[model samples]
Every structure is written in structure tokens, then in C-alpha cells.
Target: MATKTRVPQTIDAYLAGLEDPTVRKTLGALRTQLRKLLPKATESISYRMPTFKVDGDAVAGFAFFKNHCGYYPFSGSVVPALKSELDGYATSKSGVTFPPDQPLPAKLVKTLVQARLAEIAARGKKPAAAKRKAPVGRPATTGFRVGVVRTLPMTAPELWDWVTTRPERWLGPGATLKAEPGGQYEVPKRRGSPGVRGEVRVVKPGHRLRMTWQPDGWKKPATLQLTVMPKAKGASLHVHMEKLPDAEAREAMRERWSKVLARVA
Candidate 1:
């Protein structure tokens, strides 16, 4: 079998290789937005896509494909909320796509990149400061395990309503949840910022949610399962994340799920 082709270095070189005019133009606009919002970003390609790295780590990236162009916001989870405005475009968990003839929302794109950069800065320092030693033992391999449990003070149906109807109320600042399996859930760039422009993933209500969460370049899809157990007063929520590549990612996912669940509950 032949080897996969490598990605280009600079954003210009990467875009130049695309055969579709629409994908090329959209990527060009994204490039402009990245440079304007993050002056210090170093442009390159990672994972066969154009990536913008900051302080030696990728913050954002974009890709031109046959049917759609992918816009990656490395810090997808922590970006300022923008769920309402994103309705105009087609979006998935990790990125958004603009139709061939449509003009991209340059301003919103800049806001997303900046928000992701800020989020990276907030989380990057923790690993260094903690400096904990790793245990010398065979680690447990529990292939991706994702589940969601019920939150307190709410009946299963009530929590379901909140998740399906008013998701943003608990998910975070300017975030919204959807009820149906294929429905759309959004997180706006910021409170009252107009539009929901974050990850759009599989919404398996009362069961699991499979969504892409990348505010920048690294586009890995993560799935979360929400298990609701009936309690005396309320329901106990157990969230399990699964199918992650390795241990470090699994740990980070645990923390992320815990935080999001805590915010919602």
C-alpha cells in the first residue's frame, strides 16, 4: 500500500493544493482571521491539515476537503459562547463549514481563535506545576467508556427537559442542549454574543452524546454517555467517556466531563 501524503507547511502552500475554489476561498478567509486575531501564531500543517501553533502548541487550524472545509478551534470547549449566531452555518463538534458561495463570519472566527488561545493558556501550566510522578504498574485499558448520569434536584424527565430544551442554562455560559438524537446543540462565543458556534455532536438523549470538541487544530472526536440512576431525592449522574487513544487523553477527558457535568447539574 502507498503511504499517505504529508500536509503542507505554510497556510498558503496548503490552500494552493486544494482543487476546489470554494474550499480554497473559505480556508483563505480563515487564515486571514487567524493572523489578525493571533499575531504570534506559527502556521503549519499537522495531521494533514493547516494548523496554527502558539507557544509550541497548536491553537487552531483549517482543512479543505472534497465536500466541506473544516475549521478547527483548538480550545473548542472553553471558547466564549456563540450558539445563536451559528445557526446560519453547518457545523459539527470540532469545526464548521460554509457553503461554496457563502461568505464566512470573519469577526466570529477571530473571536473563536482568540478564545481558544486563552483557554490553552489557562490549562497549559497545570501539568508543569503539579509535576506528579507516574506509578510504575501496568495501566488499566478500559477502551473508551462513555456514560451520563442524572443530576441532583431534578427528576429524570426534568433533567431530560433541561438537556433537550434549555441545555445552555447548565452546560455553561451561553451553551444550549438538544433533545433528539440528531438534533443540534450549541455553545455561543460569549453571553449575548449572537449565534451558537461550537461543537455539534451526536445527541443520544438519556444515553450518550458523541461530539467533536476541538477549538483549534487537533481534531479528535470524543463520545460521552450519560447514565441516569434513580435516587431517593434525585438522580445520580454517571458520565463515562470512551474510545480515547491513550491514558493521558483518558485522564484529561475525565476531568473535562466532570467539569461539564458539574456545570450542568
Candidate 2:
């Protein structure tokens, strides 16, 4: 039988065992930069790595290991313009890593942090006439598109409370959810119509929510996911809808979620 892997319980313990002093120093600098750039961020150990939280939400973090130091932005994507600069390091969908001895690019890191903060701010703003430009190019495409709608009076805690404690308030009215994995969540209506349904495929609190949506009375279904994150100022919410069969479906779902998010502002 296989045994479960034991993980380090604290950031300090994880860092104290590092063999390289230079890596330690570099991570130290990175931590300092994080504090300066995101003053509200707090540090802790999560997933056996150093994690940072903002406004009581995990936003970004760093970890020093044997060969490299990892930097986690937690934001979905950094600004498009920074792609070239980020390429200098090892990057993934949610993070980057730099070699132990590589000189830390403090400014680039700062830029990335600011970009994430801006995204959080935009997410918190009200629906307005002029929209913030979508992240410059096609979002990394996926397999489906899901739409979410909610209306709650504007307040930070109110929005958080509704989303965390009373998800059913909005989702329940038009949809049905089961606690079991692979259970179906059916949305019974479209934006203006009635009697629509969908299926819930994924659910993780304060982390991810995914479901399949079919327009009321439509034959086809699309997938939707919402990823919730805490940022230095407030929260970072990302809506990814996929399996859209056409441009019109994609655009319509985007508009619907964007409008609902504006209400939280």
C-alpha cells in the first residue's frame, strides 16, 4: 500500500531547510518586494509553500526550493505585454519560477503584481458605459461557456456573504445543485425567458465553481466556471465559459456574467 506524503507545515520550516543561501536571499528579496507592492498581503504556509493573502484572501505567494524559487501571482493571467519579460523565467498558468542565482527583476515583479491588483479593481467596479478592455487577445480558449447572474445590494461583505453562505439564493432560484461530485445543476431559464437547465460538474468553495448550461428549451449545452480569489484590495473573480459552439453564445455569456459582476461593485 502507498503511504500519504507528509508535507511541511510552515513557511519558515520549509525555508529553513534550503541548502543554498543565494536562493534564500533571492526569495527574501521577493518577499520584501511583495510586501512593498501589496501592502495588504499577509503571509502563511499553504500547500507546503509560502502563501500570501490579501483582505483575508490568498492572492500570491513565493517558495524557495533546491534549484529555483517559485512566484505565484494567483491571478489568471498576467498582462499580455509582459509575456516577453516573463519568458525569461519558467511560467505556468498561475505562477513563475526563477533560478536560485538569477538576479531578481524587482520591477517586472512589481508590474505583474500591479496588473493583478488592477484586475481585482476592475472586477469590483460597477457596470458602466465604458468597459475595461478584455485582456488584449483571445482568452485561452476552453471547452464550454457558462453564464452566472446575481443581484445583491452593493457592499463588500454582502457580496462575499451571498456568494459564500447563500449561493443558493441566486443559483437556487434558477438552478438545482447536489453536494455529490458529478451531480447536475440545472439552470431553468435564460436571461429573460423561463425553464432552462444545466449540470454541475465541479464545485470547490472560494476556489472554483463549474457547471453545464443549456439555454431554456435549447438542445445543446455549454460549460461554465467561476474562479474566486482574494486580492490585496478586495476579491479577484474570473469567469470562464467554454464549449461554446459559436461566437454569439460566447459573447452573450460574457455579457451576462460581466453584468452580474458589476452589481457586486
Candidate 3:
């Protein structure tokens, strides 16, 4: 008869079972930091991982995998909300994964925890009028939209490859686009200039794409959409952007996308 293996039932037991010293030390430190940051949170093993719960809600958790370690906020929105800050890490809708040798930074961990707590607090409540105002230099959460469309001399596959392979052409120099939902992209700041960061929200290979777009220093992201369709002559490229701060921004992006489309054409 084969013997049954035991599973860890506590955080300490989980740590003790880790055979790799690097992973053990890294995750142990993370546990300590999580406890400190979430002093009021109840700690226990949930879903086979070490989890922290607040007010009967699981707010955070962590577990080790074959190639990486993961940090879960237990909220689908938290990871996406902080996509700009999480450029170098691998993220899914539910968790962020990092190398076992590199623990998540304390500042980043704190920010993640705060975002989760704020989300929990905001539930079942309405915001005051004052709280509805956009952060400085940001557009209101609703209103102000612009779009531009152009027909190009290429097939849908050719256009998709052109755009996805060389996203920096439109996204800015040094930009990267993963071209899949929940995948992240960023154009790093350089020489005192601002850069862009965001995550893909939708993707329909060779057909359509939608993403959140936010430049450096913006408090919230705006939405950007791109669509490709087969045309009688060639293919059509449509660019739509929303959540502009004012008429000036609307016109600016309108011109920008128009120029980009012209270049593509």
C-alpha cells in the first residue's frame, strides 16, 4: 500500500515544510510583514494557503508554486487597479506571482493591503459628493470621449501582427503590449518625460482590443479601444479613448489618434 502524504494545516507548518531555504525565508518574512500590516486580520489556512480574513472576508493569501510564489488579494479588482505599479510582476485576475528569491517589496505589499481594505470598506455604501471629484489632473470617472477610425491597406492578420509586434510605434517608445486580457504594459519614464502604463482588458485576436490607459502621475486610468475589421478594399482600424480631463485633452488625443491612424494607413 502507498503511504499518504500530509498537508500543512497552519502557516508555521507550511513554512516548515518548505525544503528550499530561499523560499522558506522569503515566505516567512512575508508572513511577518503581512501580520504587522494587517494587525486586526485573522490568520489561518484557507484554500490550502495562508490566508488573512477581515470581518469574515478573506482579504489576502499567499502560497508557493513550482516556479514562483504568489500573493493574492482575494479580490479580482485589486490586482487590476494596481496594474501600473505591478509592471515587472506576473499577475492574473486573482493573484500576483514573483520569484521565490525575490520577496515583494514592503511598500508594494502595504499598498496592496490598503487597496484591499479600502475596497472592503467602500462596499455597501455610497460616496459623498466631495468624494466623487477626480484626483488632481485626472478626468472625472465618467464623461468625455473621443474616437478616430481609418482604413489601411492590409488584412486583419497583417494589421494585428503589425500593431502587436510594434506597439511602441503608437504606445510610445519603450512600450510593451502583451495583447491579452489582464496582461500588463508600460512605457518607462525617461529624461523627465512622462510615460504610460496600463493592462489589457479585452482581446479578440486579430479583431479587437480594449485596455486601461494611464500616463505617469495620473490617479486613475482611462479606457482605450481598438478594433479591426475586414473592408472591401483593405482593413479598418478604429481608436477610441474615454475619460478625458477636459476638452483640451479630448482634442489632443483626437489629434494623436488621427495622426497614428494616418501613419498606419
Candidate 4:
């Protein structure tokens, strides 16, 4: 069984769930920095995590996990722009993970935020022929339905266990799963009901697990993979889903899966 951590209903609730005093302080500082950078940005919880928006677009987000913390600038562009200054940190094109005890430098954080702002502000300057799809909130075709990665303060083995075993604390009564390749993963559609069926295509204990995930309306199953990697603090949980039928399906399931992933974590 995994430790029981309360799900925050709001951004305040989410911040309050930060058990470490230092974590709470660091996140508070980061939030303050974000506000100063984007004074007009609104605060909201997108993808079940705390996020800040500017002009109705997501500018940044931050979250605390078991071992470390994460900061997302909502674009791959920002990471590369500041990559030189981010050496000695684990960074991907999307975001970076830093030790919670020692948050990323204030200057670097500011630079990352500034890069994102410049990217957003410069959008209007692009030539009509060179314009890319509209930003997330606008009307533009998107690449994937949803793509996200989260880090936690737990070892790979622990995260692997948590991912394989689930409780009905949130969605339903309980869940049934196996920790092997070509295994079964069934959960109740509702409390006290028969489980919706699914199968695991690949399982590497404590490292990676790929499974078939079928939602309620699906004509066929789309593949969902959970890759767990060791982190300085605990582990990094990477999730990807594909074969969504349409943009509507992707948008709908993106929210639903966001909630489900938080719980499964």
C-alpha cells in the first residue's frame, strides 16, 4: 500500500499539502517570483497541479514530489534557451527537476520565466507564412492529445509498486493489477461494479511499464506507458498515451487522465 496523501481541491490546498516547511517556503518563493514576472497572470490548477496563466495562456507551473520538485514553463523552448545556465541539473526539453532543499537559483528561475514571456510576446511578430499553431488555449491543431511528465520523491521500486497497486479512494471501490509483462489490469467502472478489462504489454519491474488503457467510450484501446526512472531524490514518472481517436477524445481524456495519474502517484 502507498502512503495516503490528501488530494488538494485547490491551489491553496495543494500548497498546504507540502509537508516540509522548506518545501512550502520554496514553492511560496517561486510563486511570488512568478507573480512578479507576470503580474497579470491568473492563478489556477491545470492538470491537477498549480499553474499560472498570462493572457489566458499557461506561462508556468510548479509541483512538489517525494524526493525533489519540478518547474514547468509550459514550453520546450524555454529549457533550451536557458540550458547553458542549467548545467548540473536534470533537464529535459519541457522542464527541469531540482532538489527541493536547494531550489534552482532565483536568477535562473527568473531567466526561465522571462524566456517564456518573450516567446509568448514574440508570437505576434512571426510572419503569417511562418506562424505556427495557436498556443494551447487558442484554436490550433495540437500534436498529441496530451503529453506530460512528473517527478516524485520515491524510489523507482516504490513508484513501480504504487503504479501497479491502486485503491478506490478516489474513482471507485478498488483496483486489480499485476506486476508482469502480458498481465491483467482491471478496475471497477464504478464502486461495487465489475472491472473494465485491460492488459499490460510490457513491464520492467521498478523501471518501466507499458500497458493498454481503454476509457469508457473507446472503440479500441490506446497504448499508455509508465516509465519510472531513478532520480536524485526518488524517481521520475513519465507517462505517454497514443492512438486517441480525435481531438475531442484527447481533450476529454487529458483531464480525466490527469486526475487518474495524480491518484496513481
Candidate closer to the true structure by lDDT (higher is better), 1 or 2: 2
Cα misplacement distance, residue 250 of candidate 2 (Å):
18
Tens-digit lDDT track for model 1 on 118-189? 344333323543444434464333344323232468776666565556666644566665555455556666
Q: What does the lDDT read for residue 47 in candidate 4?
A: 72
Which candidate wins on TM-score? Answer: 3
Using lDDT as the yardstick, the better of models 2 and 4 is 4
Q: Report the lDDT of model 4 for residue 104.
A: 76
Model 4 lDDT, full chain set: 0.68
lDDT of 3 at 224: 80
Instruction: Give one digit per residue, the lDDT tens place, for model 4 in 28-130.
Output: 8888888866677899988767999977879899998788889999987568545557888998888889987898787888667655654454343335753
Clashes of 2: 14
Candidate 1: minimum summed lDDT over ten consecutive residues — where?
A: 141-150
* Local accuracy of candidate 2 as per-residue lDDT tens digits, 1-265: 9999567676666667667888767777777777766776777887678777766666677886657788776765553324556766767767787788885587777656655554453333324433444355655334433333322343444444555455445454545565334765554555675554666666665456666767765567766565555544565555555577776666666566666677555
Give Cα-based local distance difference scores for all models. 0.57, 0.60, 0.78, 0.68
TM-score against native, each model: 0.46, 0.45, 0.48, 0.46
Better of 1 and 4 by TM-score: 4
Query: Per-residue lDDT tens digits of candidate 3, residues 57-128?
Result: 888899998879999999866787566679999999899999998899998896687667655543312256
RMSD of each: 17.2, 13.3, 19.1, 17.9
Candidate 1 regions exceeding 4 Å error are 1-6, 76-81, 124-265
| lDDT score of residue 160 within candidate 3 | 82
